[model samples]
Target: MHVVSARERLLTAALDLFAEHGVSGTSLQMIADRLGVTKAAVYHQFQSKDDIVLAVIDPALNRLGPIADEAEAQRGNAARREQVLAGVVDLVVGFRKVSATLSFDPVVMRLVRAHPALRNLQRIRRLLGGTAPDPGSRVRMAVIAGGLMMAGADPAVTGLDDEDFRDHLLAAGRRILKG
Candidate 1:
């Protein structure tokens, strides 16, 4: 069995609570209660819920870091562009369940909107920035990200498991690029 640290436990617990209850609905007390610890112990691990929020999100965003590298390395190649798009989709889809909830959460969105790291996020965005076909690229990017997130958790895509969803998404992506 893998022994988990308090930090990992806090992150897992935070994601669960935030998914069930939006960020505002959740509290350190709830997280501590879930872990059978006191709020102070939770605080000792993280100074604030916002800190925990960042911690939970950091892992997902970090995946994009590499996509940024791949994008820069490939420069202006069509293949490279597709690779970046495919990779971004794969990363989000890889964490579909949590990503789904986080993607839709108002608090998460608000925090991301106000995050000091906004400029830093631009680096990752720049990686796949050119993939957007036109002005609608923003909407398309959201759809692609949200699609991956929701598709990961979608039950109606019944025959579609994560792997299946990814395959379909990648195909859809190719089609999106072509037409």
Candidate 2:
């Protein structure tokens, strides 16, 4: 059954390919083949590979706002810290297949750096502070974000099912946040 629009199908396929192969490695032809369409058809929806990459990343990027807001709304420092960690864990675990790519892919990382939606990184840092004038807080936030991406992509973690993995990842994130 046809479950989604053509653009959605293209985005989905491009995301899968981008995850498997870095943006530099994925081609429009591969995306077309995944959707059983021609390269021209894919082009009809997106002007360039970069456009498809941006679109495929939009959903995940869209998630950062709510996460930042949820963490920022908390009353206490500890509460805010925990919320930030939880939101990050959910974001990473929810987008496990693409999380690593989002973190490490040069193309995606460049786009993210330019994208306005991700400006919330500053707010996320403020919310996850370690101590006043906290130099460690920034590093802590980076570690948590980077660690989740690496862990999610790690083959060793795959032996556990999704629920188990999610549980373990969340646990590890909590420990990381505490230390």
Candidate 3:
């Protein structure tokens, strides 16, 4: 059997708590409690809540690098846009709970906006045809991206099987991109 490290345990517990409560609402003590460890043990692994939050989110945000690269490598605008939309949909659906939690969480959003990861996120947005500087274009981008994230995270759609959920989500994303 594989052994789960203490750090992994902390991250898993943190993600769960962050999803249930906003990042600010989740404390290191809570994570330690969830893991049946002492707070000092958790601190040994991570210096602060911010560090824990960044560590929890880094893996998911790091995935955007390859997805963005693939879209950027596409030869045509339409193809690049389509590739990005598809990639974003996949990423969001794959990390459904995290995507939903991060999408609506003000604390996560603030950290994300300030963090270096925002660069890759912006690249993904631009590659997905969200590049227009106009306010309307901005709104469209938000609607499409936010909609996909929220939809995948939504409890209402959990009844659908994975394939069907992905199909509907992809179709909606395609329509939004085309507009």
Which candidate leads the pack in TM-score? 3
Candidate 3 backbone clash number: 0
- Which stretches of model 1 miss by more than 4 angstroms? 116-159
lDDT of 2 by residue, 58-109 (tens): 7777888888899888899889878877787777677776765556789987
Greater-TM-score candidate between 2 and 3: 3
Shift in Å, residue 178, candidate 1: 1.7
> Candidate 3, overall lDDT?
0.82
Better of 1 and 3 by TM-score: 3
Give TM-scores for every candidate, taking all chains together and pairing residue i with residue i.
0.80, 0.84, 0.86
Clashing pairs in 1: none
With a 3 Å backbone cut-off (N, CA, C), the pairs that clash in candidate 3 are none
Q: Which ranking of candidates, highest TM-score first?
A: 3, 2, 1
The lDDT values for all models are 0.72, 0.79, 0.82
lDDT (10s digit) by residue, model 1, range 88-107: 66875677757656877777
Give the poorly placed runs of model 2, Cα more than 4 Å off.
130-138
